[model samples]
Target: MDCEILENTVLLAIVTLISVVQNIFFAFKVENESKIANSKSSQKTSSPAFDKVYTANQNCTDAYPTFLALLWCAGIFCSQGPAAFAGIMYLCVRQKYFVGYLGENTQITPGYIFGKRVVLFLFLMSMAGILNYYIGVFFGSDVKMYIKAVSNTVSPFLLIP
Candidate 1:
């Protein structure tokens, strides 16, 4: 690979790592706040509502890891506008996340809902698009070499250090 590509990859990796760490901390805060708001003051406790809150909180664990995956994977795929694309993807997930959780009883949610299937689909496509562009940009050898570059990245990296 060209040294420029390697340099860009390193920079992308560092930014993504930092972004992921920040997201994890943010998720914890969101979970704690949700727990407090969801908590009952006068009620005697012990209910499915609490269970729902716990489950929702548990789902927040992937907040940062997902971002990290997007970052690294995006670095492998996108040529530019990574932050913008990733940000849009993140916002999309947040909207879908809340709607999915409340989807058990009905399709529509009062605020937002969470759904695994939707998240899975969105994440996959978003990452794929980013990855595709990444391969096409710095790494590709020719105008038509995008797919080849992607294949190279997906393939095993045997000791080139």
Candidate 2:
């Protein structure tokens, strides 16, 4: 395999590793927080911290499928290296968002803002990949060659690195 392909694979592997570890941490935090809340009260209402943890976990769980699908779609169709880099950034920012949500203030944090931006970027990249393929199919263009041509024209100006 080409060096670039190997490097992209490594980047993706690192992202996956970090994401798994982060998710495990989040799960532990949520469970710990829940336990603390339960110890305090048997009422339907949980503690504020517990509520925040639950919300954060729920939001992540809701978005997980969509996020992973878009991530892989962009990685395969767009530039894999950049896609993987974006994935790393997304994971990092998402962790911050999760942690920040557990704080006393529930207002949107910097992490939340940056995470949304990263998600928007990933969405656009995934759309570009999918759209490129469909456009090729409809226009009877050489899909791979045409995508390469278009990507070459656009990538030089991108500040991906």
Output the TM-score of candidate 2: 0.73
What TM-score would each prediction reach against the true structure? 0.41, 0.73
Q: Pick the candidate with the highest lDDT.
A: 2
Give the alpha carbon lDDT tens digit for every residue of 7-26 in model 1. Answer: 65765565655545645654
Q: CA lDDT, every prediction?
A: 0.48, 0.72
lDDT of 2 by residue, 1-161 (tens): 79977765676667777777888888998999988998888786788888889999887767766767767776777657666767877887787778777774554477767766667766777777788788778996645555545544553333332
**Backbone-clash count (model 2):** 0
Superposed by TM-score, candidate 1 places the C-alpha of residue 130 at a distance from the truth, in angstroms, of: 11
The parts of candidate 1 lying over 4 Å away from their true place are 1-46, 99-140, 144-161
Provide the global lDDT of candidate 2 against the true structure. 0.72
Top TM-score prediction, candidate number? 2
Model 1 weakest lDDT span, ten residues long: 152-161
Clashes (N, CA, C under 3 Å) per candidate: 18, 0
RMSD of each: 10.5, 4.5
